[model samples]
Target: MRFSAGFSRAAAIAGLVGFGVLIWAAVISPARDWATSNKVALQTSRVEAARLDASIQRLEQEKAALGIETEFSDIWQARQIGEATAKVQAELGEIARAEGISLRSIAPLQSPDIPFAQAVAFRVEAEATLDRVVALTSAVEFHSPVLIIDRASLRRLTRPGRISPQPTLLMQLEIMAPVFIGEGEP
Candidate 1:
């Protein structure tokens, strides 16, 4: 039997179309899906890297601030224990005089043994009004050198014959000054 030319041509065209569809299903479709997933992963990684960079900048700023505070504290440190105590006493006397407070006594106490530094303590007794005492305490706190008020006591003074308008208070303060030991010192 002889086949028609039109029928053979149509069969060949259908075979070519079927082969093209098979190749697309086997290779090209899976490759396209993989490329799409990799693009999404790249975007996510970029976002994470930006967030980490911002956090690093913030930490650096905090470290710089801490360094400045440390330097400021170091500038106020004293070298010798006895000299620090005497200087603290003189400063207290000056503050009392300026605030119109009468300083009864200023005596040094036993120094405390601290690591890398010595703490020189003092017992200060003064008589003044409440306002004057408050002013004196403020002066000590805001002074250039670092002065710590370890303990404070205020009591009303009683007089037998003399009746005054404003009551006088006896203020007792325990102040500490830190003296840093240098490398060259013994």
Candidate 2:
């Protein structure tokens, strides 16, 4: 009878210990895991927010450098439709001469009036070294009345003289200039 009682007490103590271990595994371990995951998520969110802030700052700097704010304030600088074609031709000729690009031909195409503006189309054919052609196009882009290139095609020109081994490029460009209807010539 004494052995039986001792056995019963030992079994009860063992059962209590097993129950404690089960509780620790089921509840405490899961709570710790949840907290750790939440910490990781919060850190990820902070990193993403920092990246977005940096992107916004970069975009703002680009806007400022473009002078967009000042460009739009008081007046539109593009020429009126009536004066744009002639002015654009003159400007393009001057740029071609300065950039050392051979001007083959430049002719203004007749286009219908666009809303509140005239769309003046011009076709330019020129031949030069690739570098000189690039320079000419860049100069045209920075010109006051904005010139938009609609179509461009480049072909390798047959070398006429043994001046240089570098292949020359013949560039055909179609450009569009938006001339506001009511604006005056500058």
Candidate 3:
């Protein structure tokens, strides 16, 4: 009887040990591994998000440095092609006058086909000193609403048998500007 009772006690202890091992393998171990994997994934996501945020900030700073406007209000907008061309002419005349340029002719040229905007072009003939011409070109290039000096022809005027200081130049400039049509208009 003593031997049987000892054997029974040993069997019960072995059963409890087996049960503990089963619980640890089937439930606790898998749960712990799942938690670890989730933590790792969360950390990785945070790192990626931080990297994206930094990139966005860098791009925004670059945009600001380049003087790029976020709104389209600064762009030239007109309801008609004639209006756009007139505005371009007026602006060019003003700049030329300010730079002491004598405009011989200012004529509107046919615009090229552009998507979502109309290109307003002009053929401008002017007489000015070299310095004034350079200043005029610079002003047009840096003008708000954006102006492009597509083509420029400069000729130095010389008098026969007379040498004059600061020779005058004949400047023919082809300037272009993009004009956006207003909403609900063709």
Candidate 4:
């Protein structure tokens, strides 16, 4: 009987160990796999969210720039070729006056043979100190009304009569600008 009791106790311990292993295989193993896959998916989602946020920011910046371009287009559309040229001339005159430079002439280049709707060219002559000339030219190039400098030349002016307050240089400029033709004309 004593030997039988010892054998039964051993059997009970073995059965308990086997049942624990079966429970781990059936439930714990699958739970662990699911937890690991869920963690991986969460990480991927976080990375995707960051990328989308960056794209949104870039699009917002582009939209703001487009707004500025649209405003400039509206201003351009409101004026005709002659009005645009006159506006540019006025702006240049203001720049010259501000820089204390003498604007000699602002005249349209004769393009009788070519269609007037295509382009309008201007020949501008000015005399100013070197620094003032540089400032005026920079302003013309950067300011609106979109003037393209086709040709630019500069020469030192020599005056033999008397002592001038400041040395001056002569600048000759030829600039071309696209003319806006009304829909009715062409």
- Highest lDDT: give the candidate number: 3
Q: Give the TM-score of each candidate.
A: 0.55, 0.62, 0.58, 0.49
lDDT winner, 1 or 4: 1
Give candidate 4 regions above 4 Å deviation. 1-75, 111-118, 161-167, 182-186
Clash pairs, model 2 backbone? none
TM-score, cand. 4:
0.49
Q: Model 3: residues >4 Å from true position, as ranges?
A: 1-70, 184-186
How well does candidate 3 match the true structure in TM-score terms? 0.58
Candidate of highest TM-score = 2
Scored against the true structure, residue 63 in model 4 reaches a CA lDDT of 85
Tens-place lDDT per residue, model 4, 50-147, is: 99999999999988876673333312222467766676567667877887887899888853233324466778898877888788788767656566
Q: How do the residues 1-186 of candidate 3 rate in per-residue lDDT, one tens digit apiece?
A: 999999999999998899999999999999999999999999999999999999999999987866864454555778887888888899999999999887999998889666556789999998887888889999999999888899999999876886756778899999988888675642
Q: Which RMSD values do the candidates have, in order?
A: 8.0, 5.2, 8.7, 8.2
Model 1, range 107-129, lDDT digits (tens) per residue?
Answer: 99888665545778889998888
- lDDT (Cα, 0-100) at 126 in candidate 4: 88
Clashing pairs in 4: none
User: Where does candidate 4 have its weakest 10-residue lDDT segment?
Assistant: 69-78
What stretches of model 2 exceed 4 Å from their correct place? 55-68, 72-79, 97-102, 108-121, 127-152, 159-169, 175-186
For candidate 2, the TM-score is 0.62
Question: How do the residues 1-186 of candidate 2 rate in per-residue lDDT, one tens digit apiece?
Answer: 899999999999999989888988999899999999999999999999999999999999987877654342122235555565776778778888999886999988876455445577889998888888888888877766677777899998886555765668889988777665454444
**Candidates sorted by lDDT, descending order?**
3, 1, 2, 4
Better of 1 and 2 by TM-score: 2
